[model samples]
Target: MSKATTSKARILAAATAIAVEHGPKQLTLDNVAKKCGLSKGGLMHHFSSKEALLKSMTENMLHKLEEHGELLKTRHSDALTITNVIRTKKFINEIIGMNEAKILLVAAIENRELLSSVKAAMLEQKEAIMSEPKSEMATLLMLAADGLAFQELLGISPFDENERNQIGDKLIDMAIALEGDLHE
Candidate 1:
């Protein structure tokens, strides 16, 4: 990547780490700069303010999700179907392990306006899923994924690794059955 692109990415990554580690209220340009080993002036060159940084992070999260959705289209041939949603391994990993969701949650609480684009993107995805032939199944699969994500984000998930895997396998089986029914 270009130097500017690398710098911007490092800034965003540092900002996200700060948000996840210290909470959004503690995230500041100075902290991000210190974490990124950049001077505050350099950080400002990439992100003028904390809000700008958070906004960019949120946009990056949305872009990554869209990319994953496209990959699902190639893998499953029906991106909006329950099968594709259930088989979202990359998204599942991100939802469970990455700080992007936590950053967005903190940003939304701190400044609702920052999430307007995120909300719009989510609404667009929902509309597409609602138009699918197996809309109910798609909704169910999405809800299950969201529930797991929320539980993980809040550190309240009760499932151990084996249990979580069992649950995921069961859901995949259900999705496969749904796909079969659709084909028939």
Candidate 2:
């Protein structure tokens, strides 16, 4: 990546880390600049406003999903079994618990354009899932993942790695069992 790209990524990372540590309500461009070791003017050179930075963060979320989109398509085209689908669902659950998702939602609520863009992407993803045979189950998995992630971010859920893993395993098993029922 170019230096510009690297720096922008660093800024976004800094912003996300901060928002994840403190709710989005407390986030500010000055804080982000300090976190990135850049002057406020330099940060402005990259993103003229906090809204713009938040929008970038939202775009970053879609970029992440796109990273897995091709992989998911490939898996769907090949093997395409229920077990693989369950595994993918579990993976998404784990990803939602990640800091990235926390930042995405935080940014979206603070920036209207970011919220709209992210909502569009989410709608598209939902439509894609609806096109699949296991639409209902897939949608449920995604909703659960989103809810769990938000709860984790808000400290409403325990963030222990072991507990997360166990919950993931249970969710996957539940999906598999649901798939079996659909088959019958």
Candidate 3:
């Protein structure tokens, strides 16, 4: 990648880390600059304002997921819609850290345009998967999964490792059951 691309990537990565550790309310240009080892002037050259930076971060995340959507089209044989959503959540939890995700999610929601895009994607994905059968159940499954993640991220009844595992297993079971009902 070019130096500009690398620097932009660094800013996004650093912002994510800071947002995860602190809240989005705490995100600042100085903190992001220090984290990425860029001078304030350098950072400012790339992102002139915090709003711009947040917007870029949101787009960066969506672009990354779009890449995953492409990968899923090639790699998965069946149920790519639901599977990809589940896998994407898992990827976020593993790679981005849930706390960071929570902060980013909240921040993104505060941006009207960004929130609309997010909501549209959620609706589109759920509708696609629910088209199979037991559509309501599939929708419920999706909502429940999101709820668990958000709860964990927000420290609202945060789950222990075992609890997280158990919840995941239960979600899988729910998916399987829905599949059976749809096929029947």
Candidate 4:
């Protein structure tokens, strides 16, 4: 990566750590700069304000999932609906058992406006699934994934790790099976 990319990543990493450890209220450019060993000016060079930083953090999560979605799209060719399921699975994986993800989620919840990118991504996935013949099944899968995220995001997980994994695997299997139905 270029220097700026590396520096911005470092800044984000430090910011997340601070937020996770001390809460979002404790996150600040000066604090992040100190944590990342960058000057305040250097940090500002990437993120001008807290809103910009929060926006980047939320988009970063979606970008990782989208990157995987791109590869899936190339392989499956016509499995657009299944891609949404896979993206949901990836998103759930990103948040489950991840401190940084948990923190970022909480931060996003606190700043609802920062969640627009995530909402947009969800809308896109919903649109794709709704266009499918087996849309109800696909919608159910998406809802399951969203419910899983909320369970973790709210610290109200009702299932053990094994059970949750089983559910996730089953949902992906169901989504994959829908591919043949789409062409029928």
TM agreement with the true structure for every prediction: 0.88, 0.75, 0.82, 0.84
**What residue runs in model 3 are displaced by over 4 Å at the alpha carbon?**
69-76, 105-112
lDDT of 4: 0.74
- lDDT, candidate 4, 75-178, per-residue tens: 55556575455654554474545564665565565688888887888798889888878888778878887787668656689987778777777777777778
Question: Candidate 3, after superposition: displacement of residue 22 in Å?
Answer: 2.8
- Cα error, candidate 3, residue 27 (Å): 1.2
lDDT of each: 0.77, 0.72, 0.72, 0.74
Model 2, residue 66: displacement in angstroms? 2.5
Candidate 2's residue-wise lDDT over 1-184, tens digit each? 9989998999998998898888788679999999999999999999999988888887887676666655765765422233344455456656664677776667657755667877886687677667766778767876775566567666688657678677767766765665567657
Find the 10 residues in a row with the least total lDDT in model 1.
89-98
Model 2 residue 23 CA deviation in Å: 3.3
- Poorest 10 consecutive residues of model 2 by lDDT? 77-86
Deviation from native of the Cα of residue 43 in model 1, angstroms:
0.8
In the range 26-121, model 3's lDDT, one tens digit per residue, is 688999999999999999999998878887877676677677667755765445356556656665565655654554564665565655555677
**Candidate 4 regions with alpha-carbon error over 4 angstroms:** 74-80, 87-97
